[model samples]
Target: MTQAMSCNEAAGLVRSQGAVVLHTSPTTYDRYVSGPGMCLLDQTTEPAWVRTADSTQCFVGYRCRAIELEIGQ
Candidate 1:
């Protein structure tokens, strides 16, 4: 089952495995090409984990289950 995790946790997971999508801009979210999870750039924002040494864009953590599923777990 999908779990409620901090953005920090999600960043780690995405960094290692990859996410279905990496939300950058709200309007651009749907436009992102569906492919391998985005590389978590060092966005200087919150959660601290996603922050890297290059990028300043930050993805604040989510409070809800960030992932959506089609099958029952």
Candidate 2:
């Protein structure tokens, strides 16, 4: 049986699910120069699990891969 989890709790769940996880900080910021002023973007990279299913919930033995984003142009 699989356990219900929140977005934050899904980090450990993803690992236990035999998925490749990419963990990051809570306050991930990206600063870039857009024309004149600088643009500051804030996001969360704690842990996002992507599985092979369309449903929101996944089984315990499910597989997931954490997504990575590249900053800068």
Candidate 3:
């Protein structure tokens, strides 16, 4: 299931998932394209095996089920 997460939490999740995390923002025309275009903002800060597409415009991680996320109020 998907959930709304803060930037900090997203970073932590990326680290634990053994996935490469990147921060990105689209260029002027890139933002208006039918498909989104992403500009890399930062390089990977942690070790991960996930390969990100060049179009990636946000920091995201991926990995097998190891650590579970705790949800609360």
Candidate 4:
């Protein structure tokens, strides 16, 4: 199983890799991106908050979510 990482580490991965699938818990994971360019045509980039080893809610990078979904939020 993938181990939890720090916010800085996660951010670094996104910066260097452009996109990454980060696992916050054993079953919880999300795809993070360095910028909106990585998102699909129907998706937009939003702040991604996740639990890290050193913080409960860390701002690592951006997450791609459907544009329509974000509009309702």
By lDDT, who's the top model here? Answer: 4
Tell how far residue 26 is off in model 4, in angstroms. 0.4
Off by more than 4 A, model 3:
1-3, 20-73
lDDT of 1: 0.34
**What RMSD, rounded to one decimal, does every model reach?**
14.8, 14.1, 16.3, 3.6
Estimate, for each residue in 1-69, the C-alpha lDDT of model 1 and write its tens digit: 012344454455545543334434333332121122342333122232233233343353322223444
Clashes of each: 1, 0, 0, 0
Q: Supply the TM-score for candidate 3.
A: 0.24
Alpha carbon lDDT of each predicted model:
0.34, 0.31, 0.31, 0.81
Considering every candidate listed, which one attains the maximal TM-score?
Answer: 4
On lDDT, who's better, 2 or 4? 4
lDDT for model 2, please: 0.31
lDDT of 2 by residue, 1-73 (tens): 1123444344444444433332222333111111111111332233222322233532222222234467873
Superpose all Cα atoms of candidate 3 onto the true structure and report the RMSD in Å to 1 decimal: 16.3
Candidate 1 vs candidate 4, TM-score winner: 4
Query: Worst 10-residue stretch by lDDT in candidate 3?
Result: 28-37
Pairs that clash in candidate 4:
none
- TM-score against native, each model: 0.25, 0.19, 0.24, 0.81
Error of 3 at 21 (Å): 11
Which of 2 and 3 is the better model by TM-score?
A: 3
Give lDDT: candidate 3, residue 30. Answer: 12
Model 3 residue 8 lDDT? Answer: 46
